[model samples]
Target: MNSTRFTPADAAELYGIHNWSSGYFRVSDKGEVEVTPGPGLNAVLPDIVDEIVARGESLPVILRFPQVLAGRVRQLNEAFRTAMREYDYQGRYQGVFPIKVNQRRMVVETIASAGYEYAHGLEAGSKAELALCLAQNLHPDALLCCNGFKDDGFIKLALWGRSLGKNVVITLEKFSELERVLKVARQLGIRPAIGVRFKLNARGSGQWEESGGDQAKFGLNAGELLQVVERLRQEDMLDALVMLHTHIGSQITDIRRIKVAVREATQVYSDLVDEGAQVKYLNVGGGLGVDYDGSKTTFYASANYTLAEYAADVVYTVQEVCKSNEVRQPTIVSESGRALTAHHAVLVVPVIDVTGPTRGLQSIPEAAEDQHQIVKDLEEILANINTRNYREMYNDAVGDKETLHNLFNLGYLTLRDRARGEALFNAILQKLAKLVAGLAYVPDELEDLPKVLADKYICNFSLFQSLPDNWAIQALFPVTPLDRLDERPTRQGTLVDITCDSDGKIEKFIDLRDVKATLPLHDPGTRPYYLGIFLMGAYQDVLGSAHNLFGKVNEAHVTARPGGKHLVELFVRGQKARRLIESMGYEEDMLRGSIRAQVDRARAAGRLDDTQTVELEEDYGEELLGYTYLEYEE
Candidate 1:
């Protein structure tokens, strides 16, 4: 391999860290990733990892930057404010961070505290989330939006918010929720503020496009909407309607679809105002996309427009529609959860081991004289392989490999010969790969050889526990090495999580032009190597499931103080084996007793000594408190 030199700026541009990180992370001059917690301050990521290790924390920990969260909130609000001022719109812009994006207490609390300037609020989709929001000491005027199907308990909690003088708006997703809201409000002798989620005819563009339009699972139809208005008027509660909400979907890449939905939602708001319902807020619900791949295209993983452009389109469309109808412009509210939180947290995992077909074999061994004929054929193919006839040699190698396997199964070829044949086949493939590396266009038959030659990096993390989105929906997150930015990577590999399941691997990676089949990485020496998966603070945390009994990982909330100082505001340890089993409804004491009984039985049978018994019991007890992940010394 040639010696290639790289700069901090080169690494930044290569991974598009600047595009999505929003100035919070960059490659430093020390050839390590630097965290810009505050303006003109920097902290290296390797140093942070060292600090975390010093505290006895394990690998696969989440590093959160609260300043990045605050910066996003500021960017969203400031963009809308700038757009409203540019368009001369009278209504103000207020946005809420939906708790579903990242329901962790630290994440939600950080957003709430940082968003105080913008009067930023919280959006809850479930009862527990609603109760959480109610418990937070949010700004008095901060809007609390309740969505989804509400039970009696959920509605009462929302009503309780109203009684406490908070700006609580219960958005009716289904028609039945309205009756529950009304009945609960009547029981409490409080008039609750209400919002209606409209099922718009315009469909968004992306993975969640089906979340909107007439066929959506949520929201009321035109006839149902009219019935709601008529019933509210009959009950003398028309004035309670204060917000009109519609969500086209999340991660909307196209700007035109947003403009269309905004226009449609504003028309509904204006018509409701004309009907004397007194709706004061026009809420175009969350669809703000993040540029995950930094391609700025209409791809499923990228956003076609910038946040400022999104705000401008939303502000201009609403203003134009209201002006055309001669109705007063209502206050704009956006529930952009993903955009606010995707950049706040990063999942850092270490590459523990590297495995590949060529991992052990250094050179092809000379074929034994008494070797099987098929093994000899494979060796000949490897020996005769050259640039002119690599394709033919590859075909011969494949045919001989299959035949050797068949012979071994039929008791014809010995295990020794089979191993030699397998090694020779792989070695030939590696040689052919090098020959084809410089080709302008590889042949179709050899196109997949490079992928087969790709190394498998065994990382210390659970795919199902940490990054379920990548496993479930194939979502692409930015992945790059945290250090060694000045040297070029000499190997290509795919990340394999430390799970027993074969599906727990990340094969697709983000590239500037298109999706890459493999990620370039360095050889893992005696020291530990770390890679970070960026922009995972959105739905990954809450949506993750306890697959393979791997629970939540350790989390550290990092605060970049002035004078380039770093502080860990919060540290949450990962789940232990006993806790993980208990979470699955298995009693820890009962399991321990069962294991202890087996050990005592062995001791009684003279299979153990006192020292062995004590050691066994101590090991068992220690295993209970040990981390679920594999622990190692760095």
Candidate 2:
């Protein structure tokens, strides 16, 4: 370690916190990660967690800043508005937050409440989500867009929005859904507003490019779309067509693809106007990307374009196409659910333990004469290794460790010998790690030694329950220590969750240059340490699965008020064992009875007295009602 001073700025650069946090988060002078949710309002993340812990809450809690949520909503809408102003666009911009991004009541309600000022609305991709939207006290003019496949009941519920004076648009996912819509409208004797989702010839760039082109799972082909327009014309229902929509997928990376898609969709929009259909809105459905990696590249985890650039391309491209076609410009609609919600919720997990190949592990001393030949060879490498012979000694130690392992397995050495050999090997690697860092250039084989020797941090949260996207889709979220930015990180490590599954660990982390196989972390020792998984508000909460029956973690909703004040408005405790099992179809009473039967059997077999049986039953009952996660003693 050098004698130079380290600062929070250095830590910020090391973790790329400023690179990906947008503007909502930063490190304070006191080495704490401070979140500024609104003007003149800020809160320290560790301080909030301390408050929760003070109330006897457990590890792995989610802290949501509704003010931060409001900030994102405002930022997105303002981005499009700025684009429109800069591009001199005549079409108005309205953004809708699709509930599928994060169907939690607090999340959706925050967006709806913040967005009502800009006439922003809700988009539902399922019948249940549509019901969720209908229950909100949304702005009267906000577009309540009902997407996805529609049954008769789905269409009827959406049509009922018209009776209640809500601006509901039933978008046709497929040609067949249009028939169901018409049937429901006829039965209700009300002409409902309609939107057609078109399958574009232009494709997007990223993991979900197929969501736009002709191979899309939903949306109508050119011929099918024309047929719908013609049939609507025949039934004098063409005027009900109020919106033209297309989605190029979520998290689109490239700006060129968006420009292409917008141009193509606008051409179709102009053609529909020429055919006498009254379309008031051109909806470019959700694909605004969040730059997860902060690289600003076309990587799977990053976006190559800024939100401002995306808005400009959509507005300019549409204006160019509509003007060329000599048609009136329609109101621009965007359902940018990801961009509006990915930054508000932070999942804070505790580091219960830290491990490595030889972390705090002691080796026994033995005479050289009694040591095995392979172990002696490793001991020699440990003795003579330096910056000069380090390369050769590293190679020799690597070979000797394997041979030592084989000799132990073959009964040529005892457990103590094996332990000594393992310690020597870890020592050799640690020495090589230091030597390789000072070298002008390291060999390719030795370059990865540092990452391989990094520590393993055992976190107290289940990745399957809190950050499922990272497991399922390889989404990279920024991981950083909540406090301790003033000190230098002494080791690198990967995050391992407390799940039983072998795959429940975070190996890949976000980096400005590329993905990191390991994260720089501090040693927690006997004290409590915390790590936060940021930008997890989008889809992660709703998409998580209860693998190992972990269920949901505790959640705290923090509202940042003016004058640097904040309040913990709500704290939602996680699922208990009883609720988890009951949700899995196990009756609570039956489960209790089964345990009681076992206790009775034990009592009858003279394994317990009456007092002991009663105590055991009470303990078992209390455990059943306890939190599903592991409990720690205070």
What is candidate 1's lDDT per residue for 1-634, written digit by digit as tens? 2325667677777777887676778887767887885677766777878799898888889999888888888889999999999999989998898998888888888889988878899999899999899888788878999999888899999989988888999999988888888889989898989999989999899899999888898898878888889989999999998999899899998999999999999998888888888899999999999989888888999999999999999999999999999999989999999998898888999989998875534655656779888877776777788889988888888888888889899999887898888888888888888889998889999988867889999999999999999999999999989998777777889999988999999999988798888888888788789999999999999888778788889989887766446788788888888998898899988988998899989999999998999999899988788888888864
lDDT of 2 by residue, 1-634 (tens): 2447778888888888887888788898878888887668788889889989999988789999898889888888898899889978887998899999999999989888999999899999888999999999888889999999888888999999889988999999889888888888999998989999999988877878878787888899889888998989889999999999999899998888888889999999999999899999999888899898889999878899888788888899999999899999999999999898999999999998877764522543454457777787887888789988887898898888888889888998988788888888888888788778877899888878867887889999899899998888788999999999999988889989999988899999998887898998888877779998999999988988888889889899998666445689999988888888888899989988998999999999999999999999898898788877777997
* Range of the 10 consecutive residues with the lowest summed lDDT in candidate 1: 358-367
Q: How far is candidate 2 from the true structure (C-alpha RMSD, Å)?
A: 1.7
Q: Which regions of candidate 1 are displaced past 4 Å?
A: 1-4, 360-366, 561-565
Q: Any runs in candidate 2 off by more than 4 Å, and if so which?
A: 1-3, 358-369, 561-565
Whole-model lDDT, model 2: 0.88
